[model samples]
Target: MKKVLLLGANGQLGSDIKKVFKEDIELICLTRKNFDIAQDEISKLNKYSNIDYIVNTTSYHKTDECEDFPDKSFKVNSSFVYQLAKYSNENDITLFHISTDYVFDGMANEPYKEEDTPNPLNIYGLSKYSGEIAIQNYTKKFFIFRVSSLFGESGASGKGGNFVETMINLAKKDVPLSIISNQYMSPTHTLDIAKAIHYFIKNEIQDFGIFHCCNTGNCSWYEFTAKIFELTEINYPISKTTYEEYKTKALRPKYSVLCNSKINKYYKMPHWEIALKEYTNIKHRKI
Candidate 1:
């Protein structure tokens, strides 16, 4: 069996990857606390040099929090990525790095593609884009996947859980939700990302470069929330708001819907609406 080292095992995406790769591959899963990349814990790979792939799912992704700690943001998102890229290059290991769609300035009329030039509007986006550049410069065998608005079974520990669950919890209070309508995105599911990774590793892709691995289609935050309630049969009031009205420290991409044509060449990407409905169904079964 081919061996793979997965970092950030406890995060939403990493956790789902653990589920997807079980019994199919030789996987070594490590959480951030046990395997801190910022401290250079990656040097321990010398003991496991036989590892074939390294998938990094760790990031300092609290959008507003990134503005408060620019140093930490760059350290986790860019500097550590550069270190990993250098290591992957030297050791001849395939590196799969998870990236964000925030790299765009949210000004495009069309969905962002792999070839488009990045113009980040916030510190978070800048740091992530910097990481992408570092990986391209430092390693030849690397895959950078740009995903947007991720929600999954495992709640993001630092961000008070994933957005969908957070919104559901807020709706329990029977209060009106002021959601941003101007800002749109392809609200992707972490499960789809895990399956995409599985496809990439199984097919042994040779074209190692940036790929947009988000769900198809797009919707505003308000519409996404409405769909969540509609699927779950929950009655909640949702008010339309704009980026300006919903003030935040970090400037988010007003339109972050990613085009999946590049990755669709390798694996089929399901629509966001279908994925969202499936997620709600799974959540309901558990409850």
Candidate 2:
């Protein structure tokens, strides 16, 4: 079995990846406390000379927090990525990096393809986009998977709470909630993403490039929350609002629906909606 090193193993996607790949591969999951990327992490990782693949899911994901900590964000998101890319290239090990859909400005009327030019509007997006560029320029053997609006069981309690959990919490208080309706993108389940990554690794399809990995269908944040309420039997008052009205410190993409045609053509996975329903059913014990 090939040895795979996973960074940010406590995060949503990293946890999902651990669940899926633990039995299949020799896995090394690293937490921030164990291995911080800000310090001499690349040098430390180089000590693991036998690792076959390095999957980095660690990111500074606080969209608003990035505004105040742009330097920290770049240090983790961009500079660390460069270090990993350089190390991976020298070591001849495959690198799998997770990126965000926020790299786009959301000005396009259609879903973003792998070949589209990125125009980020916020520091978070810019940092992620910088990482993407670093990977492209610094390494040739890397897989960059860009996804959007991720939600899963592991995400429910960490950092900023997930949308599903937040809605569930609000339901307990019987309070009305307002969600932005104008923003649109595929809300990908972390489990499905993990499965896709596993498929890529197992197949050994090493065509290194960027791929859009998200659910097949597109929906606004409001619609996604509404579905969550409906599925969980939560009788909370949820209202649809515009992004303009719910002004955030960070500017979110109005539309960032990623077309999964590339991934579909290369690797076969279940449809995103089907995967989402499966996630909800498994988590809540009902759909």
Q: TM-score for model 2? A: 0.96
lDDT of every predicted structure (CA atoms): 0.90, 0.87
Q: Give residue 92's lDDT in candidate 2 (0 to 100).
A: 85
On the 0 to 100 scale, the lDDT of residue 195 in model 2 is 85
Per-residue alpha-carbon lDDT of candidate 2 for residues 186-264, written as tens digits (9 for 90 to 100): 8888888898889888888778899998878788888888888777777678788897898889998889999999998
Residue 51, model 2: lDDT of 87
Task: Find the 10 residues in a row with the least total lDDT in model 1.
Answer: 278-287
For model 2, what is the C-alpha lDDT against the true structure? 0.87
Q: Candidate 1: where are CA atoms >4 Å away? A: none
Which candidate number maximizes TM-score? 1
| Per-model TM-score on C-alpha atoms | 0.97, 0.96
Per-residue alpha-carbon lDDT of model 1 for 188-245, expressed as tens digits?
9999999999889977888999999999999999999999888888888889999788
174 Cα displacement, candidate 1 (Å): 2.1
